[model samples]
Target chain A: GAGVSQSPSNKVTEKGKDVELRCDPISGHTALYWYRQSLGQGLEFLIYFQGNSAPDKSGLPSDRFSAERTGGSVSTLTIQRTQQEDSAVYLCASSPGINYGYTFGSGTRLTVV
Target chain B: SQELEQSPQSLIVQEGKNLTINCTSSKTLYGLYWYKQKYGEGLIFLMMLQKGGEEKSHEKITAKLDEKKQQSSLHITASQPSHAGIYLCGAVGSNYKLTFGKGTLLTVNP
Candidate 1:
């Protein structure tokens, strides 16, 4: 893809339901990141994937949040038993390498009611 | 935990005016990146600064990293309506993760 692509630009789900957000990073980008932005808040790091290495999950807010990158190209972020607090913009970014500026996708606005 | 603090939570300026936004970090930054985001849109990468005391400019936007590497500023000269958006500063930490400030919302009135 020419740039990072995210699916389901907007999602509204009932609380307790699970949701999956997808990200297709730029071709050959070795680094991928997931971030969540609540209303009027900063971008909060959720997870990071570098090549085939184990993902850095230190930023995940809780065990209910999990992500996986398949074949080092596409990634999926799944939020289990979503809560109202999970309503926010979920952003995905990719870079060629560490310390490089990232290209971010438009993001998925999740609303858990 | 690393934290980035941005000042002037929001600003409204008339077109042709100049404005500056600041971002301070609790810890030394290895990399600082500037991005612009419209409401409900993705972030647009503006610039990246790595070295202490380094400055970079693109068009009317200039970003500077202090020698201490703990703070950065983004200045927009002759602001235009197109510049209205949320300006964010992100810093890369030792863990290779990026942490961002809450952002400064700039409103350039034409």
Candidate 2:
């Protein structure tokens, strides 16, 4: 891909329902990152994947949030029992590695009703 | 807790005016990167500085990292309306995560 791509550019789900967001990073990118952006706010780091190793999930807000990168390419972020506070733009970015500039996706705007 | 803090949460300036935004970190930063985001849009990478006392410029924008490595500044000269957007600074640490500031929203009126 020419740039990072995310699925379901917009999602509207009722509270208590689970939702999944997907990210396909730039080809050959070794580092993938997930961030959440609240309305009129800056991005909040959610998780990061470096190559095929275990992901850095320390940024996840809670246990209900989990992410996995398969084959070090496509990744999925799943949020269970979504809360109104969870409504925000979910962004994905990738870089050759963390030391370089990151290319971000268009982002998925998730809304919990 | 927010590890990074940016000043001037919002600024309104006339076209052709110059402006500067500052970012300070509580911990020493290994790297600092700046990004811009338009309303309802993804972030666009602007610049990155790795070493202290390093400076880089692109067109009308120039960024500098202090020798102390605790602060950074983004200066836009002869700014244009196109430069209107939210500016954010991120600091990378040993944990390999880029902690971002709340951002400074700039509006350049023509």
Candidate 3:
């Protein structure tokens, strides 16, 4: 893991409590992504795995937002009952397929007060 | 549903002056990404245009991809101040998911 690796970079939950964000990609890099950046908004496409397929949640913006990618390389993004617009910053990217080009991490700044 | 449109949303150059950022897409673009952010963190992979008039550079930043691929452009020749920040444009959807464009805030007033 020389790149993509996210964790609790900064979090201050409160609203409803329930926040778990983690992503460790770049190992074999099969493709995994989850994004959200509210403050001024822009990158918002939360959910997409590529190895075993079946994960393109369309862009989960509801259902309390959820994500998972186990045996393929570690990934989790759960935002159960957090509101306050759900704070911001929460990105994680990894790709080594589909043409290749993606390796982002250093995110997870959710602050719901 | 791959829509990306980024234009002069913010810019204020001066140090060596030379800027140009634009990313337009309404479809067509199996791959086209260029990102740079330093405001809150995350994202820093610049360059990736798929075929059709593709172009890439990574020293003074230079990207272009238009020929019906919807459009893409990001040029920063002499600009300094570390080239400011916030500049995004990603498009590669339909299954691989990757749709962005709402960034373009570079200020290098040195």
Candidate 4:
């Protein structure tokens, strides 16, 4: 891809329903990250994946939030039994490696109504 | 606490004026990057700072990093209406995660 691409640019789901956001990072970047932007919480790191290493899930706020990168290319972020507080813009970014700046996707605006 | 803090939550300036936005970190930063986001658009990377006393500029924008103080600043020279947007600063944390500030919104009135 020419740049990082995210799917379902906007979403509105029931409070208890589940939602999945997808990200396709720039080809061969090797590193992918997930972040969330909310009204009052600002922007926060959600998770990160580096090559074949176990993802760093330390930033995931809860068990309801989980992400996985398959084939070291595309990634998906899943939120279960979504809460209103979970409503936010979910952003994905990719970089060549550590210490490198990121190329971010436009993001998926999830609104848990 | 937010590891990164951006000052002047929002600013309004006249066209052709100069303005600066600041980012501060409570802990030492290994690297600092600046980005701009327009309404409904993804962030656009502006510049990155890695060393103390390092400064970089692009066109009418300049960025400076004070590694010792864990701070960075972005200055727009002769601001234009096209420069209106939200400016954010991000850093690589000890754990290797990239964290960002809430952002500073700038509006240039033509």
Candidate 5:
């Protein structure tokens, strides 16, 4: 079985630019999540989508961060006007639902200079 | 404020030794998940605990959830060099999001 997949394994961009990271969740997985892992830091929750609904968007760091899941399959996390602080590994994960284990993608490492 | 706190920040052990890592939460946890990540890679789910006093084991790894509902521990028996990586504990609340600990960097020496 194919696991979750993310695009552009690594991205380097200048400050003030925008980057879009894409995630393709496993088939039939209705719950998708995006998280950021800073160097030597924990995984920070960004946004989550469950069947076209995001009940919790509170974890998004700021207005510059936004994510959308289309057709309950693919998800895109966009970071607007990127800063050095946003230079981290962006991770995507999908689960069957509550109590199910989540399968994560290899992640897109974003380096802002 | 961080909802979950993992201790020891790091650990180093010889191959075939035993090691334990702990995760404590400021709030009650509805579910606890353990994951391992190799350098420059995504996390791989190890185990999940949903109820207090729950215990689950996978191969050489075992996990226990306290009845108090705020703590969990992951124990590795007969550690191998392949276990060298970052161990993270994630706690889920009523919300859908998962709050992760800072992770324990484990270095298993062969």
Candidate 6:
């Protein structure tokens, strides 16, 4: 793709239901990142993937949150047992490397009721 | 923990006016990036600064990294209505994690 692409631009789900967000990074991008943005808040780092290496999950808020990158191109973020606090815009970004600026996707606005 | 603090949580300026936003870090930064986000839109990368005392300009926006490498400032020259958005500053820490500051919302009134 020309830029990072995210699926389900908006999602509204009941609390306790699981939700999945997908990201298709720019072609040939070796670095991918996931972030969450709550209302009036800054971007919160969630996870990072670099090539075929083990993802840096240090930023994941809890065990319920996990992500995986398949074939080093597309990634999926799954939030199990969603909580109201999980309602936010989930953003995905990709870069050539950690030293470069990232190109972000439009993001998926998740709302838990 | 490394953190970035942005000043002037919000600003309202008239079109054609100039404004500056600052981002300070608790730890030395190896790289600083500036991004803008309009309402309901994705972030738009503005500039990236790596070296201390480095400055870069694009169109009407300019960004500078302090000599100490712990601070950065973004300056907008002749602001326009199209520039109304939230400006965020992000920095890469020694751990290789990118942290961002709560953005400064800029509203340029025409």
For all the predictions, what are the DockQ values? 0.89, 0.80, 0.31, 0.77, 0.85, 0.82
lDDT of 5 by residue, B2-86 (tens): 3889988999999999999999999888899999999999999999999999999999999999998899999999999999999
Model 3 segments more than 4 A misplaced: A1-11, A14-16, A19-54, A57-88, A91-109, B1-14, B17-29, B36-38, B41-50, B55-62, B65-74, B78-83, B86-94, B99-109
Comparing 4 and 6 by lDDT, which wins?
6
Point out where model 4 deviates above 4 Å: B67-69
Candidate 1 — which residues are off by over 4 angstroms? none
TM-score of model 4 (CA atoms): 0.94
Per-residue CA lDDT of model 6 for B34-55, tens digit only, reads 9999988899999999999999
Calculate model 5's interface RMSD in Å.
0.8
Error of 2 at B105 (Å): 0.4
Sort by lDDT, best first: what order? 1, 6, 5, 2, 4, 3
Q: Give per-residue CA lDDT, model 2, range B1-110, as digits (tens).
A: 33889999999999999999999999887999999999878889999998999999999999999999989999999999999999999987887877799999999999
lDDT of 1 at A85: 99
- Model 3 scores a C-alpha lDDT of 0.88
Which 10 residues in a row give candidate 1 chain B its minimum summed lDDT?
B91-100
- Expressed as tens digits, the lDDT of each residue in A59-81 for candidate 2 is 89998899989998999999999
Q: What are the Cα lDDT values of the candidates?
A: 0.94, 0.91, 0.88, 0.90, 0.92, 0.93
lDDT by residue (tens digit), candidate 4, A43-94: 7888899974646888899999988889999999999999999988999999
**lDDT per residue (tens digit) for residues B17-99 in model 1:** 99999999999999999999999999999999999999999999999999999999999999999999999999888988878
**What is the DockQ of the complex in model 3?**
0.31
Once fitted onto the true fold, the runs of candidate 5 whose alpha carbons sit more than 4 angstroms away are none
Residue-level lDDT for B27 in candidate 6: 94
TM-score of chain A of each: 0.96, 0.95, 0.32, 0.94, 0.97, 0.96
